[model samples]
Target: MVTEQHSFITSAKRVIDIEAKVISALASRLGQDFVDACTMLKNCKGKVVVSGMGKSGHVGNKIAATFASTGTPAFFMHPGEANHGDLGMLSKGDVMLAISNSGETAELVNLLPVVKRLNVPVIAMTNSKHSALGQHADVVLDISVEKEACSLGLAPTSSTTATLVMGDALAVALLDERGFTSDDFALSHPGGSLGRKLLLKVSDIMLTGDDLPLVKHDALVADALLEISHKGLGMTGIVDELGVLVGIFTDGDLRRILDARVDLHTALVQDVMTVGGKTTQPEQLAVEALNVMEAHKISALMVTDEARKPVGAFNMHMLLRAGVL
Candidate 1:
């Protein structure tokens, strides 16, 4: 058992070391060709069509997704499928990103003449620039590695990693050049937590109108407590005669008043409340509101308008329920 475990650890470490070296060497190989590829992709009016065979096809799928999500329109096309009428997906004004570690993939090479005839520029990822795929490409990105991380020296391990990294470099370069923002990325990924964080606003989750926990500044601490309890927001907003928010009264304040032996019946809620408490606008992002709550160590906040009037209110529980926590 010990011998098997030791052998497993040794093999894992060796693979990691070799792959890490291969990735590190990629930086030194990036030059004018990388820049030209980025320029071609950025200038392309149509979508980026990525094609490969076998294992390279799998990597191409992910690379295409990264490109699509980062503001660069792209999609993967299996070379085998393309040969069977799917080649219609490629069109004028589009760019071809062909991945083939060997640079001699028969399925991919056969499509070169068709791709070229359509006037589409080809950017090739290969181990040798002198190979057939490279010779046909407008720009050749060398993804060469000394050897595979596979002990048999035949599997596509380090070479695939290099190809994936190169794809990432191209995608990110185009993303940066186009000035893609988080808002753009969020639009592409609208079904997950990331989308909610970027797309949800305080107005979308805040308790408005009748749900707002609000009381007159002249109200007694006892009255404020009643409002807090009725609203179940753990806090109540204290507003002045003009209906402008002036302070906040929370459970924490009640505990402090109890300790001070203040008369809840007669003490004005404004006197004991936190003056000018933390506030957020309806237009603010929920994540930004959460940041304010966390930074101030508070659990609730009053959403105010331009006139400083309490228009809405919410607490940590509301944020959690809205998936903003």
Candidate 2:
């Protein structure tokens, strides 16, 4: 007499154990066809057209996206749509990869004649080697599983998991074969943090020109404080008359002056400026600028060009706004 909760937990554990064994068995069955499939995809002169029905269609879409981002050109087409004008998407020299656990999905079989007339090579992912789609493919990737996790053995569970892992294995194999780099991946994901690290430049977010809060080196300390207030970055840059950065003045220095009884009204900016403050390049990434500020225990840095002129300024606040932080 197990409680309902106990029965639920036991059933879940049994499913987990069964699925784990299925995946482990699948891993050991990888063979030459895996390599051959990767090679075919990498060398395909045209797109890799992936098609399937039901749950297999969902996995096909993800596998196509992975292939496209990693250097292979691919797209997922619905077999159900092929009869409705989408079959025109197929072309000669293209490779068609079809996914069906039983390899007998009616909609997939319905598209085979059109795919053949278009002269596209077929790669089939299926559990049955004698299934219609399997017999027609140039390469057959066997994603067979002994049994599903379903107690009734009617639902798709272990079989779908094996297909997903096998698809990922194919994608990674092609990625390595094509020498796909992180830069390539970042290009496809420019809005993500990885894109900020790779594509964003200091110039993209730094303050520049009239926006710079700067005071002359010989300016009185009161004038430097005024510049800081005008800039709103809680700091001001001190530059030589030549517009070359000489030092930086911050709220920290203003506090130190008050503590020392120094007269802000009469003191020259040069007397309190921190010389050679941390700086970044206009071409450097905003993400790198953030790292430098965090490491140096400062919130601001001057952005310089190749000539060491103070071209721009930035602080941690700006980085957060730009999503670099």
Q: Pick the candidate with the highest lDDT.
A: 1
- The window of 10 residues in a row where model 2 has the poorest summed lDDT is 301-310
**TM-score: model 2 vs. ground truth:** 0.90
lDDT of 2 by residue, 36-128 (tens): 888888789999999988889998999889888777889999998887989888999899999999999999988888888888888999998
User: Model 1's lDDT to the true fold?
Assistant: 0.95
Inter-residue clash pairs, candidate 1? none
What TM-score against the true fold does each predicted structure earn?
A: 0.98, 0.90
lDDT of each: 0.95, 0.88
lDDT of 1 by residue, 1-325 (tens): 9999999999999999999999999989999999999999999999999999989999999999999999999999999989999999999999999999999999999999999999999999999999999999999999999999999999999999999999999999888899999989999988878888898999999999998999998998999999999999999999999999999999999999999999999999989999999999999999999999999999999999999999998899988988878
lDDT of residue 107 for candidate 1:
95
Question: Candidate 2 overall Cα lDDT vs. reference?
Answer: 0.88
Task: Mark the regions of model 2 whose C-alpha exceeds 4 Å error after superposition.
Answer: 1-13, 191-197
Clashes of each: 0, 0
Model 1 clashing-pair count: 0
Indicate the TM-score of model 1: 0.98
